[model samples]
Target: MKKIVAFSLLVYCISCSPGPEKNKDKKAERKKEIQRIAVKKDSLQRDTIEFVSYNDDFDYSQLNGKKGKEEISYINDQNNDRSFLRGDLIAIEYKNDSIYIAGDGETPQNAEWIVSAKKIKDGKVSKFRKEYNLPIKYHYSKEGEISSTYLDHLYKLAEYYIANSKKDLIKISLKNKEQLGYSVEKQKKNEKDYYVLGIYVEFEHRVSPFQWLYIDPETDTIYEYDLPNDKLIEFP
Candidate 1:
């Protein structure tokens, strides 16, 4: 009887104990789990932000029904250069029984000049606001009156950047075929709202590095984002 009980206990212990093949399989599964976690971490590090394109949401024909005012010389042309005469009044808008005509001024400074049409009503001049440099945040509506050119506005804003300034240098080399697209985003800092226009350049020919240009439509502030180097300009 003692021998029989001892043999039965030994058989039960042998069956409960883990074998070498079971231990190997467990180790392999643990290694596979660790590798999956590492791969997921690498993927998260690689994809920080995804890029997206913006739609052009402007309509030019909204100004068709409104009558155009006579084109006049630009105000605040301190240098006496009449370059403002080349561009017409951007648009005439009617809201709340008042007419607002917007135009660009000749003096290209840190801020472009804007002359608010003095005549709030039809066919009359008030001369209230002259050579005002208000930041333009006008939105074009199909029913409302507005006129804007996306390309021309961007070019006009680009002229404000200093070509020789060290801060203005964006050392991004573009391929001959690579083209850039832009989007406008609204952001806030220090309780102030700002309109930021982002320029994205495609670089498929190279190792597919990304670069971006950010411009503030309200303040005409400029910055370049270097993604590969992980550099971003800190602005006040």
Candidate 2:
């Protein structure tokens, strides 16, 4: 009787202990929990801020033709010969005597143009000198009033997309020229009108259509135009 009871107790203990399958399941559950937490954190960060590349081909000369307004020009502190014209859509933030300018991306690091009050009219200077907190978001103008800076951002975005999508193909070098840049046009899709920025790239000395990026003027959301499928797909 003693031997029989001991054997039964040992069987029960062995059955109650967690097996390898249970351990594997527990590990999987823990990994999934960690991934969920990481995704949540990333989503929160994206909601607060977005980054974009600065458009270098923006024409400041367009701003010069505005009637009843003095042309706004800035001297490059590093090189006095290099003059910069402030665009209508460029956002400027002032800190004490220094001014920080946003160049599409999240942080302002490379904008170093100095504009004197004497160079700009008193009223025009005030419009550009508004103090803003860091991590400024670019507010795109209406479809007809799109600024050169915004166009520059769109061009860079298209280039980035092409570089990643066509990794297998030999990379094509693009030159920043007036004829090779983006052009905006209105198109109707899903029974709604959207302003589309058409990206053109110069290859072998010839300008060719590269990609079309559709953007909602009101929301600033971008979509890739699918010509074959006649659809607009949201871009990364």
Candidate 3:
């Protein structure tokens, strides 16, 4: 009876003791399960943030030139980083890890600037960079149509204003006045053909008078439109 009882006890101990290989496999399985849970949680968090679409209301032609250069430089200097300007028509979009804001530059190149906001937390931007400078180029489309010449003229006009303006910041736009809209009438100087481009310039101060800019595409020159005289005066 004693022998049989001892044998039964030994068998019980063997059944209870998990082998080393089995224990290692179980630990590995638990580790994988934990990783799976973490991945799922991260995915849920990312899904909670709503995605934004590309906005086309931002016209790059509006930023052609150095109109916003001073403001851009100042912002960068203050923060040691870059950001979009106040008058910039910015379009925003978001991906898994970053938010992107794209706008146009006030340069003759019509350079489009893109800013990426990353490491977001609680709906606030923690980090950002001015990441892209896509220059506008004129090319025939699949339909064999070139971009509007009127638009190109307006871009050059804005570039000229930024180059000459004394104000630290200025905003340019095609004049909203129906009478001052784009015109392709023949303008010739020194026997060279030219087209006229007119735009409205808004100063940062409300007390400043509204200004108009006229550009000569052929000569690449700009002038201030004298409303009363109905003529283009050479711009400084």
Best by lDDT: 2
Q: Mind giving the per-residue lDDT tens digits that candidate 1 earns over 138-207?
A: 2223442223564455544432221112442122322122343344555554465544444444445322
Model 2 lowest lDDT segment of ten = 42-51
lDDT of 1 at 112: 17
lDDT of each: 0.35, 0.44, 0.37
Clashes (backbone N, CA, C under 3 Å), per candidate, total 0, 0, 4
C-alpha lDDT of residue 176 in model 1: 28
- Between candidates 2 and 3, the one scoring higher on lDDT is 2
TM-score of each: 0.27, 0.33, 0.24
Could you tell me the lDDT of residue 191 within candidate 2?
Answer: 82
- The model with the greatest TM-score is 2
Residues 52-144, candidate 2: write the lDDT tens digits: 212233422111212224333332232222222222223322111222344633222222242321122212212223421112112233656
Give candidate 2 regions above 4 Å deviation: 1-145, 148-170, 174-180
